[model samples]
Structure formats: C-alpha cells, structure tokens
Target chain A: MREPRFHEVEGRSLAYWGLAALLAAIVAAGLTAAYFMEHIGHIITGMTNQIVWGVPHVVAVFLIVSASGVLNVASIASVFGKAPYKLLARLSALLAIALLIGGLSILVLDLGHPDRLIVAMTHYNFTSIFAWNIFLYLGFIAVSAAYLLVMMERRLNSYSRPVGMVAFLWRLVLTTGTGSIFGFLVSREAYDEAILAPLFVAMSFSFGLAIFIIVLMAAYRWTQRPLGGAILERLRNLLGVFAAGVLYFLLVYHVTKLYEAKHRGFEYFILGTGGIYTLLFWIGAIFLGGMVPIFLFYLARYRHSRAAIGAGALAIILGGLALIYDTIIGAQAYPLTIFPGMQVSSSFYDGVVNAYTPSLPECALGLGGVALTLLIVVSAVRLFRILPENLADIAFDLDPHEIGATPNRGALWAPADGR
Target chain B: MTRRKAKRELDAGRRRFLGMAAIASFALAPGVRLIGSAQSSSPASARANSKVRWGLLIDTNKCSETCQACVSACASYNGWKNEGRPTDPQWIRKVAIRDSETGLARTLPVLCQHCAEPACVEVCPTGASFRRADGIVLVDRHICIGCRYCMMACPFKARSFVHQNLTDQRPQAPRGIGTVEGCTMCVPRIDAGKVPACVEACAREGRGAMTFGDLNDRNSAIRRNIAAYSTTRFRADLDLDPSVQYQGL
Candidate 1:
C-alpha cells in the first residue's frame, strides 16, 4: 500500500449548510434546555433523589462508549498491522475525538452546577472513579489526537505504531473506567458486578464499528466516492462478530445475576416485571440491536449490499442507545432493597419503583449531544484532509470477495483537491 | 457535666498560676477579677475529637406510630421543607414497615446512620460527602458538584439532591440548588454540647425513645441500653458500623 492521499470534502453546498444549520439549531435548543435546568434546578426534569441519573446520562454514556469503540479501526490498522484499515485510520481517530467532545459536553451541561466545572477540575478526590474518569477521558483525547498526527504526518510515521499501541491500551482502560462508574456502586443491586467492565468493552466494539461503518459509508456516498465491496465486507463481518460478542457478554451478565438468588429480584424486574424496561431489553436491545444486525451481516446476499449493511449499522446504533436506556433508567426504576424481607413505605417513596418520563428539556439536551457530535464531525471533515480519496479501489491481500478480480490501481488513485 | 469537669481541670492548672502572689489576689477575687477568662468557658467550645463517637439509639417499642416529632424537628432544624413538594428534602423520615408473612407492622424514623465506612463518602467524586473526625457524615456544599453519585451510593436512601434554588436557608444548615443534602446528625448542636434537635423533640413529646450520646463513653446511656437490650443496625450485613441503632424491629 502506497502513502494514502487524503482529501477535504467540498462543504460549501446548500445541503451541507442546511444540515449543519439544522444540527446547530438542535444544539442550541439543547443548550437552552440545559440552561433552564441549571437556572431552575432539576425540578423540571424527571430525575429525583430516588432516580438520580436520567436521560442525559444515557445519552452521554452512549456517546462516550461509542467514542472509544470508534477507534477500533485505527487500532486494527496501526496496532494489528491491517493494511486495508490503515487508510481509514485518520477518519476513525477524528470520529473518536468528535464523539467524545459531544458526549462530554452533554454530561457537563447537565450538571447541577455547570458553572462549578472549575471546582470539579480543581478539587481532586483520588479515590473516586468519577474523578479518575475525568483524567482518562481527557487523556484519551490528547493521546488519540497524537495518534492522528502520527498517522497524518509523514515525518512522524515512525512513531505511529507505538502511539497507536498506547491509544489502544488507553481506550480499553477508558471504557473500563466508564463501565466501572456503574459497576463499582456497591449500594445498587443491579451493579457491583465485575462483568460490567468487560461488558462495556464488548459494547464499545459493536457500537463503535456500527457507527464507523455508517459514517464511512455516508461520507463516501455523499462525496461520490466508491466505498467498494471489499472493506465493507470485512467491516460487516467484524461487526457481526462484535454483535455476537455483545450477546455473549449480555448472556453472561444475566446468567451471573440469575445465579445469585439475592439478585433474582433485580433480574426479574428488568426481564419480566419491569414494564417499558422489559420491552426494551427484549425487543430493542436483544432482538433488533443484537440478533437482527448479526443476521443481516451473516446472510451472504445482504452482507455485501451497501444498503443492507447501512441498515444493519443503523439498527446497531439504535440498539446501542436503547441498551444504554435500559441499563441506566431501568436499573434506577427498580427500587433499592434497603431492608430485607420487609415491606417498606415512606414519604421518600421507599420500596416503590421510581417513575421517570423524559421531559422535553431532557430530550433536547440529549439530542443536542447527538447533533453536537455530527456538527463536529462534519465541520472537521470539511476543514481537514481526513477522508481518504477513492477508497473503493484500494487493492489488498485480504479482499475475500475480490481475490481473483483485477485491482483497479491506476483508475483509483486521485490527486488531493480542494485542500 | 463534662463542661464542669473541664472547668475544674482548667482551675486546677490555674491554681499553679495562682501560686504567684499578684496572680493569686486577682484569681482569688473571683467577683472582682478575670473578666473574659478561659477557665470557666464551656467544653462545647472545644473542637470535636476522635475520643468521642456520637451516636443515636431509637427504641421502637416506645416510639408511637402517629407521632412525627423527630421528623418535624429535623425538617424545621434543616429548613428543607419545600411546600410539601414531592421532591422536598427530608433529612429524617418515618418509614412504615410491615412483615410480608407475619403482617407485623412498625414505624421507625430513619436518617443518615453516619456509618464508619460510609458508601456515600467512598463514592463522592469531589470528596464533598465526608465523615467528620467525630463520625458525623456531611456534604460540604461549597465543594459539591451535585452529580448525585452519593445519593445513588447511599444504602439507606438518606441523601436528597436539592432540585431547586433555595432561599432563607438557616445559618446553621446552609442549602442551595444542585447540591446533595442529608442528615448531618445535628453537628452544630452536637459541637455546642447539646443533643440533636430530633432527640430533643422526641423527648419533649414525652416519648424519650431516642437517646443521643458519645458511643465511646462506656457509661453513656446508649451503650448501657445496648448492653441491656438487643439493638440492631439496619442492613447490618453491609458491615458499615452504623452509629444509629434501633430496638424492636
């Protein structure tokens, strides 16, 4: 593989401006919602002393988890020495950074004291996982940016391998830290399991790849560049494997919870008794999020179809979001059993499930995070040479579908334009 | 009491200073001398220390189901009532518990246990939730980011996030928007050598069901009652070493 040439997308079109404007509007609404929540306090939202974290957490965690997952393509190329993925590394790194910034913005904006971010940064409680995550997330951004630089600059090419290795390790730890935020909560029955860390890693892999495929395909299609069948096939296959891996982890987590009689109530509540949670866990997270995507990828006819692959990716993304909702809101809805074998009732709503219906402000704030992610990605791509030119014709040894087909080497190479 | 003993100790040390003739004349003439002196100062002015671990013992047998003296006292003391809003902060509350099989019902006032190993303290991102040297767990609103991680980590569900802006906060217990609040075990009163407001209210109601004292003192009434009766900590299996104990579950 020769030096991969990068190109800047022509971002001055009506469609481009319109999309950017729309996303910016959504972001503005989200900011406005955050302002109201902060000004008036959390009384406007569904979150309470019982269900402390709400939709914002779901949105933020999904974005943060997916951010770490988005870098797997770069890791595969730079760390595992996959030639095909090497060309796509820059875009992956860029997406990771954009998604992280967007996710973190929602998280910070939703804070009770968004103004007190300085206080959070200045005061370091070394023992808290939340404090540790602040450093991990910031460190990931810095390291991944360096990784992108190493990939983009020919002069720094020698450092790319080591830097990529560091980024891969850091991302693993970052996702683990994210998972442990809930995992280490000893007071909650649904958490305190060791599986949550690994479960998040698996979730990141699936969610990240699904998002990467969608972005790659969209960028290629909108720019009139051929995405080719080869890379898509490999990505589709990897996505299927990751979806399966997520299912395996889910099974292990549920089984582990079920094995302990003490945790049985929680499992039953989420699996059977819990109303909306049960539906989401079964239909949204399990069936559509995991199984449907896996099936779409495995079917020979649809596996190579760009539309089917995109659909699969979209399903996974939606599923990932639902999974987060199920985990976060669902877990909180089930009342904490503070007292054993006693029917407890109090003014504080003890022993009764807490109700949370997402308000418009919460929806705005959460969706604002999504729009912010897209805005960053679109703006960044327009400003930088992140997207590879003519990805369709890159000849590689592992193109299973094109083993005997002649490589369109001369036809594929295009000069960098619109710099 | 303890203040009298401390004053006596200060006077004994002051006697050595009285050995000097000039100082002796001034010290001996109590009615005419030594204004604003430290020897007669109350022990409550002294800083809280580890030598005493303040605790509460609640006897359910003596507690009446209809009474909410402790809860009302705590709310008034903390100033957390927000027009009876569903999200209003309740530092202390009465929980009505009934056995599922036996159908035996009882009422108990629950608040922050001030655990030796508090889950809220451990999970606090900014160390805002902290246990004092004397084992009073409190949230320093100055540093609290209002992430509410402590609310999730508290086993007793004792913590409340201030959902709205607060006004006219009591000088003793200052609260605001977006900070976690909980039962402070009446630290300000405890520091002033007075029992917690809830305990005082309960006793004033002629129940005398609640006792607040230093757990480390062997002769403390709480320790004596624990020795004489079987008192149980809520969720004792967690090994939190709760300072609050209850009799008659």
Candidate 2:
C-alpha cells in the first residue's frame, strides 16, 4: 500500500468535550478518593492484614499488564514484517504508553506513602522482584516511546525493526516480571505457580487487544473515518486465539494445583466453598471473560455483528478484573498454614475466610485510573496524527460486508441502528 | 516441683547466670551495651555486629489459650490496640491450633519470626524491611513505601500494615500512618538490657513459657533448652531459619 495518510481528529465537537469533561470529573473524584486514603488511611477500605492488597491493585495490574500486551500490533508490524498491522502500529505504541502511565499512576497513588516515590526510584533492592519491576516498567515505557519515534520519523524508519525487536523482548520480560510478582510468592497457594508468568502474558494479549479494538473502533467511528471490516475480522480472530491461550494456561495451572495434595484445600476454596471468589472464578472469569468472548469472536451468527465484537471486548476486561480479584484476594482469605496437618484459629481471622467489601474510596480510586487511561488516550489521539485518515480502500477491497453497505454516519463504534 | 515448673522458675533468673564480666564481653559488646549507649549518648555508637543472634523459645504446653497477657503486654508496650476488627494491628497474638486428624489442640503466642533470611526483607521494593546483624527482622519506617509486598511474602503472616493514622504511638515504638509495622521483638527494650514485653509478661503474670537469649551462644538458655529438647520452627520446610523456635507442639 502506498504510504497511508494520517491526520488528527477534529475534536472540538460536543461529544468530544463532553466525553473529556466526564472523564475529568471521574479523575477528580478518584483523586479525592486517593486523598482520603492517604489522609485518613487504608482503614477506610476493605483491605486488612488478611486481605492486604485490595481492589485498586486489581485495576492497576490489569492496566499495567494490558499496556505491555498492547504493543503486539506494533511488534507484528515492525518485528514480524506484517503489512496489515503496520497501519495500526502508531496507535498501538501510543496506547501502550497511555495505559502504562495510567496503571503506574494508580500504583503510586495507592501506596502507603506515595510521597516516597523518590525513595523507590533512588533505592535499589537488587534481589526484590518488586524492585526489578520498577526498572522493567520504566524501561518498557522508554523503549516503546523510542519505537514510536522510529516508526514516525521517516528518516529513522529503518531502525523500527531493530527497536521493535528490543521492545518485543522487553515486553516479554515485563509481563514475566508482572506474573512473577505473584508467582514468586511462596507463601500463598494461588499465586505461587510458575505458570502464572505465561498465564499473564496470555492474559495481556487478550485484554490488551480487546481494549485496543474498542478504542480503535470508537476513534474511527466518532471521527467518521471508515474502519474496514477486514481489520476488525483479523483482530477478532487473533483475540480468539489469545483468549484460548489464556484458557489453556489457566486449565493447566488449575489442574496441576488440583493434583497437589497440599493445594487441594485452596483449590476447593476457590472453586467451591469460597462464596464471592467462587462466583467470580466461575461466572466472571470462566464463562463471560473466557468462554462468551471466544464464542462471540468465532460463531458465524455473530460474526458480522460489530456490537457483538464490542461486547466481547468489554466482557474480557470485566472478566480479567474478576480473575485478578479472585487470584489476589481469595488466596489471602485462606489462612496461612502455620502448622502442617493442623487447623489454627486466631483473633487474626485464621482458618476462616477473610471477608472483604471494597469501600467507595477504593472503588473510586480504581475508577479514576480507568478514566485517566481513557483521557490520556483520547487527548493524545486528538493532539497527534495517530489515526489513519480512512481505511476505506483496505476495507472496501477485502471486507465483503463493507463492500456495499452504507453506515448511518453518526453511529458510535458500529452500524448499530438496526442490528 | 515438677520438671516443667522448675524450668519456669529458672526462666526469669537465667539471665543472671552469665557472669557480669562474661555479660560485658559477650552480650553488652554486640547488643545491649552498644545499642543502649547509642540511644543514650550518640548516634555514632558502635554497630551491633553478627557476633550475637537473639532468639526466643516458647513452650506451647505452658501457653494457655485463655490467657492473653503476652498480647496485652505487647499492645500496652507498643501503644497499639486491637479494635477487634479485621483491620486492627496485632503486634503479637494468640493462636489456637489443633491437629486436623487427631484433634489435639494447643495454644501458642505467635509473633515475628525474625528469620535469618527473611522473606519480607527479600521482597520489599525499597530496602525498608531489613534484618539487623543480630537477626531481628525490622521495617525502617523512614524507607518503607507501604506496598505490603512483604506481608504477601511472609509465610508466618507475622507482619501487619498500620491501616489508619495513629495519634497514640509510644516513643519506644514510633509508628505513624501508612507504614508496615509488626512485632519488633521490642528492639528498644532489647537494647536497654530488657527482655521483650511479651516474654516478660509471660514470665511475670502468666505461665513463664518464653525464654530469650543469644542463639549463637550454645551456652545461652535458649540454645541449651533447644539442644536438650525437640523444638521446631514454624514452616521449617521453607528453611527460612527463623530466630524464634518453639517446644512441645
């Protein structure tokens, strides 16, 4: 394809400002919630000594993991030399940066002392996995930014392949580090599995692309740029494969845990006896997040339905959040085995499931991170020539549905008027 | 007196066995004397090197579930209160453990293990969680960012995050908002030539079930007791080499 043209969206419309204003309000509320946490303390939240890391952690991990995974499109284009993904590369790199910033913001703000961020930067605990993550996250952001620059600077275009290769390798390590954050925890039953590293990589692929498709379609539709059905089809198919990868990893992880005599109680607690956790694992992560999305992506009945595809992406995000919560909080709820082959009871809530009802401030703080991510993405796309001018030529030629169809012109994300 | 009761009688006065000269040469050199002098005189006092490794031995047979003097003593000494809520900080707490199959139950007071190779110290993003030369795991509040990753790493569930702002912190245990705090093994008291508050309470008011001494000194009361009896560390399979060992499971 002759060098495709790109341009900034005309963002002065009421829809654009209204959306920005709404997100800004949410961000403000989230900040207020963070202030309450820092000002008052984590006591206001549902987290306790038992369930130490709470809902905010779930959101932050989701965004951070997805940020690393979102680079796949750019990697496919530059690293793997795929022409179709090349057109989407710029947006992919931009989204990765925005998502990372958003995730990192929540992580820092929710700290016991967000003020001591400088200390985290200055002090180096070489042995700590968490400390290693600080470097990994910063490196991923820096490398991805340079990759974007190489792709944008026509003179530096040749460097995109090498830079993209570095980014791809860095992303793998970044996701592994993220997974190992939980995996290295020898204490907890649910988080100790070595498979969590690859599981998170698969999760990142599914969650990142799901969010990418939603954002891509929204940006194109709102700007009245024709998004070809071909790209969406390819994305949905890839999303299916990625989702299956996550499911496969999870199955292997669960089966192996079940095989262990020591881990049986924890497995049963999550799969059966644990109330909210069990519900989240079965209904949210397994059915909606894992199964429904896969079916929506592949089934012929919903194949051409843009709304179905959008819903599939949304489900993956929600389900991924559920999985994060179940894995983190659920394992914590089960008491640590202080004595082997013994049941322990304590005022510290031992041998019994710890209850956690996430408070408003924790939810608000988490939501603020989401708003911040969207706001960053929207503002960046508006300020820069990230989106292609039109995918009409590519779509009209390859996508049978887009060949003769007339869209309603004012629709958001799809031709959903009568669908 | 019964052998167990006779041991209880010796528990309180065992520190006096080390001749003052021996005490001055051994205990005071690496621990109490230098740490005490550091607090009273200047910050430049000699560092407590690895010559000493403080440890505790608790006899579960004497630690009754109904008595919470050790817990109360720790709270009173540290100026923290257990509000009975899940979020409350329990520097040291009582646990009632029973065998799953045999249904044989026992009571024990669980606190910081002060592991020789602490998981908390290993995972802290900042080097806030640290082990002193004398084998005490501590959180340096000034450096702790409160990520609580250490809590996740600790096998014993021995650490607690200060969930709320505090207005009632004692000088000996200076805690504040947002930092992770746990049983310090009464570092201040240890430096001042005193046994930990919990151990003292267990000796004075309760069952005299606890013994504190330098583990490196084979002649020390704790090491002698462990050598004479079958004692085990919690989660010994992980091989963390916790300073705290227990007897009579």
Candidate 3:
C-alpha cells in the first residue's frame, strides 16, 4: 500500500460541516433541558412515579445494543480468523467504542441523580441486575478500548488476537446481561421469557454485520479505497445468515409467550394495543432489518451496489432501535396484578397505563449522544488512519514462498514484545 | 350456757384482731423494708418479662376512601408537609385497587407490611433498613446511601425515595432527599402506648376499619379480628410472613 503517509487536508468537507451543525443544535437543546430537569426535577419530563424510566431509557438501550453489534466485525475478523473481514476490522472497533459512549451518555442523562452514578460502581448490589449491568457495561468498554488500542499500535498482532477474542466474548456476555435485566424480572411476569438473552445476542451480530458493510461502502466512497470483492461477498453472505437467525429467534420468542398464556396480557399489548411497537417489531425489525437485508445480499448485483448496502444498513439500524423500544415499553405496558381475580382499568394518566412521550429536551439529548459518537469516531479516524485505504494492495501473506509476501512483519509486530 | 357464749365471743374477737393486723401490714408493705424489697423485685421481674409486638389489621371492605383523617393525623404527627407536590414523607397511603376480572374497584389503605422476613432489610448494604425487636421496619435515613435496590426488592412497592432537597425536616422522622422511606407503624405512638394514627382515625370514624394492638397478645382486638375474619396478605406466595393483614376485600 506504498507505506501509508499522512497529509493535512483542506477545509472540512460538507458532510463534516452538516454533522457539526446538527451536533451543536442537539447539545444546546439537551443542555437547556438538563438544566430544567436539574432545577425542577423529573417532573419536567413525561416520566411519572409509575413510569419512572421513559424515552431516554429506551433510547439508551437501543444505543447500547447497537454498540454491542458493532463489536461483531472485530470478533469475526480478528478473533475468529476470518480473513475477508480483517479489512473492515479497525473501523468496526471504532464504531463499537463510539456507540458505547453514546449509550452511556443517554443513560446518565436519564438518571434522577446523574451525579450519583459513580455510586453504581462504589456500592455493589450483587442481586440487582441494574448494578450488574453497570459493571458489565464498564468492563465491555474497557476491553473493547484495549483491543482497539492493540490494533492501532500494530502491537502483538498474534497475542492481541486472543485479546480481541476475549473482548468479543465479554461483549456478548455483556449484551446478554443487558437482556437479562428485563428477562430475569420474574416478578414483572411480562419479561420472564428465557429467549430474550439469546435474542439480543443474535441482534448484536446482525446489527454489527449490517453496520460493517455500510461503513465499508462509505469508507470506500470517501477515500477512493477499494475493498476486495471476495471479502464483501463473504460478509454479505454472513449477514444474510445472521439476519435469518435473528428473525427465527424473534418469532420463537413471541410464539412461546403466546403459548404460555400466563403472560397473555403482555402478549396482547405487544400484538394488539402496542400498535407502533408491534409494527416496528414486525415491519421494521423483521422485514426491513431481517428479510430485506437478507434478500438484498442474496441478489448478486444488489449485494455489490452501494445504495443497496446503505439501504440494508439503514434498515438494520432502525430495526435494532425498534427492538430495544419494544423490549422496554412492552415490559411496562401491563400492570402488576397484586390481587388475583382483580382487574384494573387502564388509564392514560397513572400506574401501568401511564403514557410517555419524549420531550424535545429528551430527544435532543438522544441526538447529542449520536453526535458525540460520530465526533469520537471521526476524530479517531483522522488521528490514526485506522481504516486501510487500499485493502487489495496490502499484503496479507508474509512468508517468502507465499504469492503475496510482504517484508513489513517486523514493523507491525516488533513493538508488541510478546507482552 | 353463759360461760360457753363468753368463750365463743372471745375466740371471734381474737380472730378479728389478727385479720386487722394482717391488713395493716399489707397496706404499709411499701414502708417496711422486707415487704418493699419483695414488691419491687416482683414488679421488676414482670417488667423484664413483658414484650410488645405491634401490628395492624385492616378491614379493606369497611375502609372509607373519603376519609383522609388517617393521612392527616400521620402527617401532623410526623410534621410532614401535606400540601404542594405530595412528597415521600407519606408513611401511609390509600391505594385504590381494581379487580382484574370484574374491573370493580375499592380503595385500600396500604402501608409498610413490616414483614417478619423483609427483603428490604436483607438487601440494605449499609444496614440502614432494619426490622426492630418490636416488629416495625424502619429506615435510618442518616446512614442510608440512597440506593434504590430496596425499592426493587420490595414486593409490595412499599418504599418511596425522597426526591427533593430538604431543610428543617422533623427530628423524629428526619427524612431527606436520597433516602428510602416507608410506614413506621407510628413507633412513637406505640412507645407511648397509644394506637397508630390510622387505627385511631378508623376507630374515631366508628367503622372499625383498622385495629392496632400487640400481635403477641392473644386477647388483643387485632388478633381476635384476624382469627374471626378471613384475611389476606399481599403477595403471600413470597413467604414474607407480613405483620400486616387485610380483611374483607
């Protein structure tokens, strides 16, 4: 690849300018809202005593799930020794780190005592799922960053491969832990399904692969880089398989809930009055997130087209968001029946029937999280030149007798010292 | 015959004198050292043996939703601000419950059940929440770290977090922002040998909706009521063995 060199570029691109403006507006609105919340308490938001956690929580979960998804590219390429995926591995790592920070930001804003968040780490509640999630998320972020650093430093390419694997495994466990936060609440009854954890795992992979393909296409378009056709095709096929798996799991999860009949009220809400959530799950998540992506990848021409890849990526992201929204909202839609044979009339104002709409401030904060993620990713990309601009010309084979041998092995691996 | 009558009268007089002397000694026992010692020891022993187990029995069927007397009494006694945004200082609240099958509803007053085996007590890392020997559960807000795990662990949703900054909080209750709180069964009242605010309020209304007494006392009205009428505990399957029992509804 002619020994990658750095050169100062001219004025910022139009895309960067647009992103900056959007970010500024979002941050300003979020700050104003946060100030109001701090001064007046959570009453400024739609969240009431019954609905303690509202839209910010949903948005936070969505970002976290997507972040976990972003980890799959590195897991597939570096840890699993998938050669075709290696070209996009660095970009995926950056996205994973970025999205996690975004998720964390949204979560902090949602807390009643944002200042007391450190208590989550300081005060350990072994039995509380929320406490466990706090630790798991922190661990995931740490391991992911370490692995990314190892990759960036071009250090211990061999030993760090296992480190990447460890990171990947940890993130999968973390994602499952997040899912179990809702799933393990047996008292809630609405979220007692055992399949939610595995379902989240499937989502992580599907969303991760979808994001990888889209980023790869964008990187190629912007930098005039050309990733190998063989690699792209392999990724598209894997994504199709993952999308199918996610769809299957989602279907089984719902069917099992219906069959149990105990949580029928929750099922009714998801399949009935939870119209928007139901549509998002069925149409956005299943068809757009799963079927459409799979179909696009199946067609030879569509798989290679930038537009098709972009559309598939957009669908997967939106679908992932919808799934998270469904999990959180669906769990709370039904009231906890303390008395058997007692029916409570659902009201729009209080208790189980409490409705929530994200205020402008909450939406702005969510947008700010997205902006922050992009800012981080773009800065990292600018500083380190993480993404390989010429994937085909970069020699993967290192041995003298190999057809694509390169003499750069010492340069890449020397700094690691096998530590 | 005259001699026999005189002898009988003499015997009766001697018996009456001995009985009067015994009565005088008993009345002056506190002044006599030996008798005083005996009386003091006996009363002290009785005091040492006595223990009070405070509890409440609520008749949900007879409870009137219209009467806020209990809430008012509790607030006034505890010096809780009853106006504005109802704060977490509410020790007792009337929760309106609806029938899941019939959609028929009734207002039921819910307070801390004061479970014998409280999950909140078990989960408090700082030991801020504990069940007393008298069977009342209380949160020592002074040491509370404001962790909401107790809230989640509680089956009855009995705990509430204080959310606003505070000044001049009542010394007896002493609640502040960032502390979990629940009904105390009016521990202050119990110590004074008076009925809890809710029980007194219910009694005053002549509905007999709430009865408070020493659960350990078999003769207590609460104990008799619970035995006479069928009662239910919220989420009894959890096996918390709650101290509070509800009747009729």
Candidate 4:
C-alpha cells in the first residue's frame, strides 16, 4: 500500500469565501448582541432572576461537550491503536481545541460581568465544581494541542500514545466536570443526581460522534476527497452505540428521580406537566436523537448510506440541544420546593412557572457560537493539511465485519449487501 | 552569613511587632469591647465573632396576614421595590401559605436562611457568596461575577440577580446590575447596635412577632424564644443548619 499524502484545501474558491464570510457575519452579530447585553443589562434579554441561565448556556454546553467528544477519533487511533482512524486524528484534535475555545467565548461573553472574568481566573474556590471546571477545560486544550503536535511531527510520533491517553483522560474529566456543574447543585430536584456525571460523559460521546461524522462528511464532500463507505460504517456504528448509551443514561436519570417520592414533583413537571420541556424530551431527545439514529445504524443499507447516516447525525445534534434546554432552563422554570405541602404564594413568582421567551439577541448569540466553531474547523482544514488525501482503500483495523462485507455503490441511500 | 542572619532576625522582629500591633488595636477598639459585653440586654455594637451567631426568631402565631410591615420595610431598606416588572428583585417577601387539609392560613416573611452549610457559598465559583464569621451568609459583590450558580444552588430562592441597571442604590446595601443580591439581615444596622429595620417595623406596628439576638447567648431573647417554642427550620431535611428559626408552621 502506498502511503497517503496530505493536501490543504484550495480556500480561494468562491464557495469557500462565501461560506467564510457568512460564518464571520454571524459571529459579528453575536458579538454585537453580547455587547448590547453588557451595555444595557440582562433585562434586555429573556433571562430573568427566575430562569438565570438561558439560550447561551445551552449553546455553550453543547459546544463544550462536543469539543471533548471530537477527540474520540484521535484517541481511537493513538490510544486504542486503530490504524484506520490515524488518518483523521489531526483534524479531530484541531476541532476539539477550536470547539472548546468557541464554547468558552460564548460562556464568558454571556456572563453577568464579563469584565470580572479576571476574577474567575485569579480567585480559586476549591470546593466549587465551576472552579474545578476552569482547570479541566484549560488542561484539555493544552493536552489536545500537544497530542496534535505529536501526530504532526514524525520524530515525535512515538510520544503520541502517552499524550493521547492523557488527552483522553482529560476529556473524560472535562465532561464529568461539566455534568457535575449541575449534579453538585443539591438544591435543585432536576440536578443533584450522582448519575449525572457519567450521564454527561455518555452524552459527550453521542453528541461528539454525531458532530464528527457531520464534519467529516462535509470536509470530504466539499473538497471532493474520496471518503470510503467502510470508514463511515465504523463511525456511524460508534455513533449509534453512544446514542444508545445516552438513552440508557436518560432512563436511569428519570427512573432514579421517579423513585424518590420527594423528587416526584420534578419528574412530573419535566415528563408530564412542563409544556415545552416535555415535548422536547419526548420528540426531540428520545425519538429523533436516539430512536431514529439507532434504527439507521441497525439497518445495513442505511448504515452504509452516507446521506442516511448524515441525516441521523443532524437529528442527534438537534436532540442534544433539546436535552440541554430541558436540563438548564426547564429546571429553573420550576420553582424551588420551599414549602413541601402548603400552598405557597409570593411576589417573587414563588410556586409559579417562570415564563421564558428567547428574544432575537439571545438566539443570535447562540447561533454565533455555532458559526464560530464551524468557522475555526473550516479555516483550519483550508490553511493546514488536516484532511487525508483518500480513505478509499483503507482497511478496517479493529473489526472482523470488514472480511465478508462488500462495499456499497450508489449516489445516495442504496442497498450495500448485494441484494 | 552574618548579614543574612541579622536581616532574618530583623524580619522576624518586624513580623512579631505587626502581629502584636494588630491584636492591640483589636483589643482597644470600641467594637471589640462591645462584643465582650454582647450578652447584655441593651443593643450591643461589635465586630462579629465566630462564637456569636446572630439570628431571628419569628412567632408565626403572632404574625398577622393583615400586617405587611416587615415586607414593606425590607423593600424600602434593601431598595428592591417592585418596579411592576415580572423580573423585579425581591429580597424579602410575605409568603402566604394555606394548609390543604385544615384550611389554616398563615403569613410569614421569608428571607435568606443564613445556613451554616450554605449551598450558595458551596457552589459559588469565586467564593463571592460566603458565610461570615457570625454565620451571616453574604455575597461579596466585589468579587461576584454573577454567574447565578449560587441562585440555582439556593434552596429557598433567597437570592436575586440584579437584572437591570440602577441609579439610586442604597448606600448601605451597595447593589448593582449583573450581580446577585439577597437579604443581608441588615448587617449595617446589626453592626451599629440596632435591630434590623424589619424587626423594628414589626414592633412599631404593635406586632412583636420577630425577635433578633445572638443565638449563641443562652440568655438572649432570640435563644429563649427558640427554646420555649416548637421552632422549625425551613426545609430541615436538607440539614443546612439555618440560623433563622420559625415557630408555628
């Protein structure tokens, strides 16, 4: 087999420039929104004292989780010693770092006092989970950069395994830290579950793989590179399994909450009475995010079809956002259980559902984070040799399924089993 | 070697002098002198000590639904008056509770519980939300980044995020937009040897329902009230060890 050479994308194309301009415009709009919010106050936005964290948190969390998840490709190749994924490892590391930076930008920009960010870095409250997250997030970025450097340098190739293991462990801790942000909040019924840490880890897996597939396909297709069906099959299978893992964790979270008589109100609110949250969980999270993708992975034909797999990945992304919304905003909407049995009423919206309507500015801010992440990924691929020349003849490195299976040949979704 | 040893000796002497100076000033200050006699009947002005946990005892049986002096007083004092907005900050508010089984209606003012193991202080990223030496939970606005994680962590919904900019902030409270604020138990008044404005207002309205004193002092009115009645801590199951105790739920 001839060794594959790396090539940078020709960024001079009109299509490329247009896409870049569009993403840049979105980012600019987001920055403007953040500025106005800071200049005037949070009163301009839909977020209230009641629903403290809104669209920005949901979007930021999604990006942060996906960033850690994006590194799975590199981890597979370097730590797990899967040869086929080695070609995609550099791009994975790049995306992981870029995505985290983008996520952090949105989070910091949306702060009550963005200027006081200096205080956040300077002050250390060891007991606070948020404080620990600062270290975990920054460490992940540094480790991922080192891993990428090792992958790029031929002389440093031997160090890739140890560094990759470190990066992998760092990502797990990062995602766990993110989940524990909610889990440590013993005050709220929706949070305070020990399972939340591992649940977030699983969520990172599913959301990250879904995004990786989407990016991989886009990069391969736009650059007119040969992305083989065999690689897609492997990634899609992993995505499906992680997607199933997400559902299992969700089940455990809800069941645990339901079993506790004290937490029953929270369960009822999210599952039954909570209007938008309930719909999002049922249709968006469970059905589209989990079921459809799992179905796609199970059917041999859909699994091999890039278009089908891409669609499933897109659904999972949307579903993941819905799940975050359900967790952050929905939980806040339900008033704290101050008085257990007595019917309590107050001027502070006590025992009442705090209404929230996401305005244009908040929505723009969220979209800006997404656009910023994609902008980095797109720009990186263009400036550097991040994409492989071809994966057409790459053999399956870690599985026996490749032995008897024939490759699918079609434009879109087609039967690959020679039926 | 001789020069280094002499310098080290001088440094140690300077350190000893500074520590002694600090202790001497503290002992001589009026606040520390007053704190020594804090167990007295008359109002005591003092720097708070770990041994003195200031708290309030509310006799709900004497609390009347027709009277809202405490609520209005808190609003005016904290400068958190309702601006007719859905997101208006409420530091302390009158909570009307009705028992479903007995139809027994009771009205009580709810504020920060000032828990020993405050969840807000625990979850705060910057440790801006903190418990003082006297067990008074406070948000140090200087360092608070207003992430509102403390607001989420608070079980009583006692904290409020300053959603909008303000021009006329109370000089005593010192609040601003984009930072979380809550009932401070009138820390300034407490320091000045005066009961909280709400407690005074309640008394002026001919309802001495609220009692404020040092909980650690066995002879204190607040301590005696708690011992004499079946007092309840809000959400006792959480075991936050709230300084504020309530009677007649």
> What 10-residue stretch in candidate 3 chain A is worst by lDDT?
A410-419
- TM (chain A) per model: 0.95, 0.95, 0.85, 0.95
**Candidate 1 residue pairs in clash (backbone atoms < 3 Å):** none
Q: What DockQ does predicted model 1 obtain? A: 0.51
- What are the runs in model 4 whose C-alpha is more than 4 Å off? A395-408, A411-419, B1-46
Which structure is stronger by TM-score: 1 or 3?
A: 1
Query: Per-residue lDDT tens digits of candidate 3, residues B47-96?
Result: 32236667788887887767766777777666665343323345566667
- Candidate 3: where is the Cα deviation over 4 Å? A1-14, A17-21, A228-230, A299-301, A345-352, A392-419, B1-56, B71-106, B111-196, B212-229, B237-243
A1-419 per-residue lDDT for model 2 (tens digits): 75777788889999999999999999999999999999899998899989999989999999999999999989998989888788899999998998898889899989999999999999979889999999999999999999989988889989999999999999999999999999998887887789999999999999999999989878876777777666777788898899888889989999999999999988999899999999999998999888999998888777766777788989998889888888888878877877878887899887778888899998999899999999988898888878888765353245444533323232235534321
After the best TM-score superposition of candidate 4, give how far the Cα of residue A246 lies from its true spot, in angstroms: 0.6
Provide candidate 4's TM-score on chain A. 0.95
What is the Å distance of residue B19 in model 4 from its true position?
A: 34
By summed lDDT, the worst window of 10 consecutive residues in model 3 chain B runs over B42-51
Note the clash tally of each candidate.
Answer: 0, 0, 5, 0
Which sequence of candidate numbers ranks them by TM-score, best first? 2, 4, 1, 3
**Cα lDDT for residue A372, candidate 2:** 97
Could you give candidate 4's per-residue lDDT for residues B1-249 as a string of tens digits? Answer: 999999999999999999999998987897866776665632222466788898999988889988989988888887776765766888887888888999998888899999999999988989899888888888888899989999889999888888778877788878988899998999988888899889999999848999999999999999888888899999888899998889988
Q: List the lowest-lDDT window of 10 residues for candidate 2 chain A.
A: A403-412
